[model samples]
Each structure stands twice: as structure tokens, then as C-alpha cells.
Target: MSDGWILGLDLGTSGLRGVITDETGEIHAEAAAPLTDQSPTTWSAALSGVLLELKPHLSRVHHIIADATSSTVMLWDNGVSSPVLMYDDGRATQEYAAIRDQLPADSAAHGATSTLSKVLWLRNHCPVSSGTRIAHQVDWLNAQFLGFPPPTDWNNALKLGYDPIREQWPDVIEQLLSPLSPPKVVPSGTPLGSVQEAVQDTWGFPHQCTVHAGTTDSIAGFLAAGAQALGDAVSSLGTTLALKIVSERPIFSPSHGIYSHRLGRRWLAGGASNVGGGSLLEMFSLEQVRALSKRQPGPKRGIACYPLRGVGERFPEADAKKAGLWPDKHLPEAVRFQAIVEALVAIEKKGYERLHALGAPAPQRIFCVGGGCRNAMWQRLRSAQLPHVVAQTVERPPAWGVTRLLADEGP
Candidate 1:
């Protein structure tokens, strides 16, 4: 491969981000656009807005790849799109319940929010014919540029019942979804040939520019953090704290909400904690949280706090009725804040312990990302608890990692 620019697009729930990078993985330009809803067209506009920002570099961009939130999918008939299903869309409760007993606890398809459930929900309520197929978020976006939806990556196919171990779609899922099938599966970084001439003309890119497969948003973030070796991990401290580690083998435990994503030859496995920055903010405003985090946090406070935000807890333990347990209101506000922050740290600690108990290696080194990772005091708190949490980090936009996919000289 010769020297040329590459584009990595990330279609996140809150927004869409794109980065232009050289073949060396050095980022040159980055752009983003806001997203208001789950509409597929919104994703397209966001992509165009980002590309327009880098229009000057579009011609030199020879390869393009993208990542989208895992499980966000829509149905396609022949070649047209249906209403998109957001990742958190959980209207598949009945369907999930029907099959939940049949699946082993280790199955990724055991949740209502899973692609497997969402597709079943659509099938039961919506109509489907011979040409009908489920398309993940990235798949739909790729279809726009490729003239038809190309194959999906293995990482995105995980929640859709593609067995990475078997390297094929399992018969159980195939039989269940009989008519409602998943898109063709491919490993991340597989080139899908040239861009549609119309898209090429509209985007001002060369007709020969290729579109390559990309993975899930979280998986892209893992790659962006540059943690590839065994035991390397990432803790995304965003709305929720998510843990993922590189392991030689896969790990899955429906009990603890743990599931592994197939990445090349290794596996990225861990669960997410319901309590994190969002929970922290519920106790105080963003500004107040920032200001409070700068304080000493005062010896983990005598008063304990669970600080859960919603009705259920998945990681560290699974309880459908779990609710936030807060310190008394009469207590000093700052003290309560410290207790909550400490509680969040505790959840992070136990999440990793859960992964370890399930056979994943203890994190040799952890690279943190997300908005909360910027909190200096929070890092201090985490480092004090988990020494392996790296202070200095190289967290790139998720887009940057997907760019590496097409930037590579692989097939």
C-alpha cells in the first residue's frame, strides 16, 4: 500500500465522529456532528457534515471504515431500510423471555437489548419477506455508500447470534430466526470494494476509494486506547463504567452481564457497571461533581453509598430491583459526594474481580477513557484502588482505531 489518507467514522448515540489519518495512524483532522434521535438518516447527515469538514482531504483518502454502537439495527427489504432499532431498545421482553430458558447463561443473546431479541421483536410485530435481513447501524451506513449493505463485522455480529468460536452462524439462532436472517458476516477490516459513483461524486472522493468493515463503538475505543496484548484493558468511565480486557480465550457469564467480543484472534471480555459518572451527576451537577472531585474525598467517609441510578444492577451482581442507596441528606453534601465516588470505584473494582473469577486475567495495565477519565481526582482515587490504572494515557477517538483497519495492508 502507498501513502494515502484514511477515514474512520464512529456513529455514536450522542453524535457521529470522523477522523482523517495517514497510513502511519497519525491523526490529521477530526470532526463531529450532533445526533438527536435513532433515525438512520441522522447518521448519514452526521457523516456528511464530518466529511464536508475534511473535504480538502477527501480526495487523498483512499480507504474508509466505520464503527457503530453494537446492537443498533434495522430491517432491510431487498435494498430499502426499515425503522432503526436503537441499541437500548428493549421492547423484546416477551421474545427474550420465550428463548431465555433455552439459551445457556453464557450466551450473548440472552438479553432484551441484544440484536437477537430486537430482531425477533421486529419479526413478531413487523412484516418480513424473502429479501428481508437485519442490518446493524454500520451496515446501513455502509449500504448507502456501497449501493447495498455489505457484510457485517464479527464484533457487531456477537449479539446477533454469530458464534465466533464456531466461525459461523449457529444452527440454534438460524432455526429461531429462520426467515429473519443477519447480514453476511466478515471480520473487521475486510475491504468491501469501491464506493458507489454517486456517493463518490457527492462526497468529493475518488471513485476507487474503498469501504472496509469496522467493529462496535466500544471495541473501537479499546483499539484506540492501544491495549492489544493479553491482560491489557480499558475502563470507559462515561455514563456508565465499562470494562474490557484482552484474553486468549472468550469469557461469558449472563449472571454478571459479562460477554466477550471477538477481535482478530483474541477476545475482548468484561461487563459494564450501571453506576458511574451518570450516577455521580445525579448527586450533583456536572460542575459540582467536578468541583467536588477536586476535594480530598476525605477518607472514604463513614457513611456508605451504593449510588445506583436505575431499577436494576447487572454487573458486580445482577438484581432486577436494585435501586440507588444514598447517604442521609442531613450529612455534609461533600461527604455524601465522596461516599458516592468511593462507591463508584468499588463497583469498578468488583467488576474486574468478577471477570477474573470467570477466568479472565487480572488487568496487567488499565487505560481509562470517556468524559469521566478527565477527572484528575477520580484517577487518583482509581489508582489508589487499582495500581495498574495508567496515569498517562493515549486514548484516541474511536474513529482513529477503525481508520487503522483500512490503513493496514491486510486483505
Candidate 2:
């Protein structure tokens, strides 16, 4: 295990990406394939394509770990099920309504996008077979190598009603999953089973290579930032702005889109704001954004803009009918864009304050990832707003995070 390489794969909505790395975090090779669709067939073929692309180093690989979109679910008997339920698929409203009232406000299972809701919907539409089992996106792929349905990781099982705090499924889940069996759940890095002989022959992996459980894509991304102790924080400035801080205690505010995900021995508590890069893109082109950000250090526009691309706010505040505010249109585009950036930093600041108010400690240091991280002005603005919080940069490839699980879990 010490001498061989570790392969970490990420089953993303758009593509499958992987990196081959050693225990010390030195990357040897990387491979990726576009996912035509989020189907088992597509994932199987894409995984093979990636492995074949990295065939030259396959013999040196010892451990395999993978992360996928949380809440994306499927079924398995002897074979995998069809019409995969995607993470964003909200067709389970009826099922969600039936059980949502029964779940606590803090419960991850209280949404239409939850895995429990999707599985309940699937069970209702399709007859459940005797040996059928529930599987997450990564769980189904792990089965290809293990030769049977494998246990899912805690991160992927959260919305499936497997409580991380108790480390077991509650009695309430039985009401929703009457006929189907939940996967035996484990922590993020627990080794499940060895790669089957046939898979080793086909993919050129070692005979005894192990496949370990992985987390949700978001958690994997968080792990990549290297926040180890309590109060360490990481922010993702993607299509949506996500804020997370490692805390000694769990925080739950589902109404504001805030909650906690167990991160090893601690809890990661934060929230997601609907206002993010998407809102910026609505008024300016990519080039315009970059140009405006570069000129930010020289800006004198004192105007403030509250730009919300969507109908409501989720994090920092909970309002379904919230409206966005914009500065006067007569102002120069440069001034306007700078105002938007300042607004975002305000929103991000408000978010952290909200977390602190809800029980999370003040952030010790903050690391940022995603498309917005490239904005030098935004980083500067964040520093100015949260003057006490140390700002650091880190590589944010989620596949790299999945690899850490194997590296940290010693033989």
C-alpha cells in the first residue's frame, strides 16, 4: 500500500475525472471523460475509458476511491436499475410531501431533492423486487468492482435518512423504504471490498486492490481545502456561494439552507446563498467581469447593489419573496460591476455572521475555491471585510480530496 499509487475518481454530473497519486500527494497521472448522461452504462464506459487512459500506471495503483453527486440514486438486484434519479430531479414532490412533515427541520431528508424522496418515488413507480437494494451514484459504480451492492458512505447517505450522529438508520426510514433495503452505511474512507478478479483483468488493476467509500462532491471539495481543526473555514464561490466551517458542535438551520455534514470527528456547518457568480453573469459577460474585477482596486463607486438572480434568498437570510436591488443604470458599467462585487462580499460576510450567530465559532482562517476564486479583487474585498480572518489558497480538485481518504486511512 505504501509503494503503490492511489486512484481517486469523481463522478461529476458533466464528466468523470480521476487522478493517480502517491501517499505523499504527488500526482502521477490524470484522466477524464465526458458523461453523455448520468447513467450506469455511461459511468461504466466512462470509468473504463479513464482507466484505459491511465493504463500505463494502472499496475502501480493499490487503492481506489470515488465521489459523486449526492442524492443521485438507483436500484440494484443482480443488475442495476434504469432511469436514474439525478440530484436536482424534483419529481419526488408527492413522496417528499408524504414524509417531509414527519422529518425534523434539521433533517437533510426533508426536501424533494433528497435521496429518500427519490427512492420513495422510484419504489412507487416501479415494483420492488425481493433482492433489490438502494444505491447512491458512487455505490452503483463501486458494485461493478466489488461484484455486489456495496455499503454507501455517510456523506451520500445523509439525505437517505441514515443519521450520521447516531451512525444508524432511524425507525422512521422504515415507513418510507418498506420493501427496499438501504446499503450498509460506513464512514467516508472505510474500505469495502477488493476489486473483483474480472475487473482487475479488464482494467489492469492489481488482484487485491481495495475500493474505499467516498463522500459527496461538495464535501470532497471541502476536504481538498485542508481545513482540519475547529473554526477552520472554506468557501466555494461557484454558481452558488457555499460557506462551511469546521465546528465542535452541529448547526442546523434548514430554512436558511444551513446545516452540518459530519467531517470525520467534527461537523462542517454552513449555508449556501443563491446569489453568486450566476447573478454577476446576468448583467455582464465573462470578459467584462474579469476586466471589472481587475479595475476594482482603483474603484471609487460608493453605490451598493443587492443583486439576486433568483426569486428568493436561501442563506444569510431566508426569504421566498426577496427582491434584488440594483444601483442606478446611469452609472458607468465599471462602477456598477464593482458595486456588485462589494455586494457579494457583503453577502458572504453576512453568511459567516449568520453561522456564528447559529452556534459556529468565528472563522480562524478561510480558504476559497471555484470560478470566483480567480477574481483578485474579490479576494481583496473578502480580506477587507473579514479583516481578522486569515485568507489562504489551496488546490481544489475534488478528485484530490477523494485520494486523501485513502492516504489518511493507513494499512
- Identify the candidate with maximal TM-score: 1
RMSD (Å) of each candidate, 1 decimal: 1.9, 2.3
lDDT of each: 0.83, 0.83
Q: Tally clashes: model 1.
A: 0
Write down the RMSD of candidate 2 (Cα, Å).
Answer: 2.3
Expressed as tens digits, the lDDT of each residue in 264-323 for candidate 2 is: 778988878878887789888998888887764655566767789867777887676888
Please provide, for model 1 over 1-411, each residue's C-alpha lDDT reduced to its tens digit, 9 standing for 90 to 100.
445788889998899998989888888888999998878677778878887898888898888889999999888887666778888898899999998877656678888988999999888877789888888999887777799868999989999888877778877888788787667888888888789998888878887798888899998888888887789989999988899999888988877888898877788898887888898778789888888888875676456678888788888787778887988888888888877777888889888888888899999999988987887667778989984888777878899977755544421
lDDT of 2 at 265: 78
What is the alpha-carbon lDDT for the whole of candidate 2?
0.83
**Clashing residue pairs for model 1:** none
Q: Candidate 2: how many backbone clashes? A: 0
TM-score for predicted model 2 compared with the true structure = 0.93
Q: Best candidate per lDDT, number?
A: 1
